[model samples]
Target: MACSACGSDSAIVCSLSDEYRDYAPADAAVISICTHCLTVDPADATSVDTGREVEPDFSRLSDSVPTRPERAIPLVLAIDLCSSIATNRSAIESLLEEVERAGTDPLLVIDRLRADPDVEPAVDLERRRHQLEQLLY
Candidate 1:
């Protein structure tokens, strides 16, 4: 995947893993970041081993995005299991299309999507939309 920060095509995923020796919380989980951008992502973290047994490292990769994306690179990926909008590809496509057309607030587009009468609001629409909004920003 391309780097989120520098937009470099050679970007990789790395872990800023916590060392238990530091007395970190028991609930601590691996954090995955774009090695090029150092942006933390939970979604990517779960897709791989993370290999962050004791400390953070970036020398390996469990997977990679096919290549550089043509548009709408996800800058702020939600590491949590809360991104409903990601599954709603049609909604995402419409939203991105509108954003391209208006070149204005994508949040407004999301609000409109949430308010659309034909669309049955997902139980977690607001929260998922918030996650999607973070991606746009």
Candidate 2:
């Protein structure tokens, strides 16, 4: 179908991926995004064909939105956290002591990594964070 706003034939309608379902409104069952103008329109669950699963053009979507490297945020956060630990031993020791009470969980580790002040927010980073949050449950 042609996009309503941009009149682009590159309009793609697809069911939201499970990984990204949380980003969509709870009521949105299917969504259509125009590749040319980058307009997103969500539709009722009944609108999509259940048998044919079409993947949205993620590269196009990523191009239009600001994004961080998907897997690198955590690694970068970890490296930065370690750097902080190396440079500020006293502060690190205090924080470690505080967190020691909570026990060590991988999800908690990710939460700490995500909360780092240096990790700037971006569309891709939020998407990855949500995906990870869902997986942990």
Give the distance in Å from residue 37's predicted Cα in candidate 1 to where it truly belongs: 35
Global Cα lDDT for candidate 1: 0.37
- The lowest-lDDT stretch of 10 consecutive residues in candidate 1 is 62-71
The residue-by-residue lDDT of candidate 1 on 1-137, one tens digit each, is 44433454433333332421121112234334444333433334464554544332323221121122111122112212234455644445444444445443545534654565543322345666666565555
The 0-to-1 C-alpha lDDT of every candidate, in the order given, reads 0.37, 0.41
Off by over 4 Å in 2: 17-26, 44-47, 52-54, 60-137
Give candidate 2's whole-model lDDT.
Answer: 0.41
Model 2 poorest ten-residue lDDT run:
71-80
In Å, residue 2's CA in model 1 sits off its true spot by 37
